[model samples]
Target: MSTTADRTPTRHTAGVFDIRTIIGTLLGIYGIILTAMGLLGDPAYDRTGGVNANLIAGIALLVAGLVFLAWAKARPVVVDERELARGDDGNAVHEAR
Candidate 1:
């Protein structure tokens, strides 16, 4: 009675509020803002020994955020239908040959 569709593996959908995406996007946006401010060559930075702290920190944050996003994409959770099936004795049943 089972069709090929029934054998397909399913993945829990990434929630509307996936933490990785949220954090990465927020960090990327903040980094862009900070980097832009730094590139403007603000006088405030001159007071800090001419170090563009905002630019350096923003670039680092941007890299970190990108890495997080990439990690999320590279690995994902999957649950198979056969894995979910159980027998009357509460043991997993194998539908294999």
Candidate 2:
């Protein structure tokens, strides 16, 4: 008897709950807050360096956050189940209806 078993690994992918999503969400939130502060923050910071560094840095962070979010969306992580049920003939133990 020649049994050519399938080599597919058992994997249960977790959708929208990966590390990328977490980092993206957190960065996006911080970006929003900083951008808001940069726009509406007090004018005292401007006197320190004669420039609104907060506004500029905030905008940069906001862009970075958006990039991370987009990257996560573009490529999501996949997790698979570790259970594989095979029959004596290298076939699936259960048949699909």
Candidate 3:
């Protein structure tokens, strides 16, 4: 049986969380909340001009969410062997045999 260490080391590229992705996720949640409130006949309607606020917010969230999702999916997550090989000083030091 091959152990995890013996197996190929998965590359973990740094760009896991992007600003746009985080913003999109938060907006999505906010939009969902507004949508739910609007649909559930919450008092938010009275404060706002009309139900359009919720509708627009929801649509915007859905669109942004999809876009962010696509971007996150498209960006490749690669394990950087070169970076790993390079030490903190950006130099590869090999021990003398």
Candidate 4:
């Protein structure tokens, strides 16, 4: 006799270890640093043809990071305990050849 609890499946999500999360975090950090430098440091107009390279790059990185983070949040990876427990034969117990 199986109870409701026994029938229920166990699941978990990939949180910090998710690739998107890692990428997003890295991009965000770089963005903040670059953005700061762009604002505080010299623009070096001669190098980039008068364009604020650091500022532009920093903003781009920030936007990309946000997008990655949002994507990760919207679609989280789910891991099912039961699926992991299954053997090649699709059963909990492995069959001997």
lDDT of each: 0.65, 0.62, 0.61, 0.84
Better of 1 and 4 by TM-score: 4
* Residues 1-97 of candidate 2: C-alpha lDDT, one tens digit per residue: 5444445656543446766567767777877887787789874564857767767777777787788777766665544333333333443222212
* Per-residue lDDT of candidate 1, residues 1-97 (tens digit): 9997776654353532456778888888988888887787573755778688888878888998898787556653333345555323443322222
TM-score-wise, the better of 1 and 3 is 1
lDDT of 4 by residue, 5-55 (tens): 888877777778789899999999999999998999999999999999999
Worst lDDT 10-window in candidate 2? 88-97
Per-structure clash totals for the candidates: 0, 6, 1, 0
Order of models, best lDDT first = 4, 1, 2, 3
Error of 2 at 27 (Å): 1.4
TM-scores for the candidates: 0.64, 0.61, 0.54, 0.85
User: Pick by lDDT: which candidate is best?
Assistant: 4
Tens digit of lDDT per residue, candidate 3, span 25-49? Answer: 8877877877776566554656776
Off-target runs (Cα >4 Å) in candidate 2 are 1-13, 45-47, 83-97
Model 4 regions lying over 4 Å from their true place: 87-97
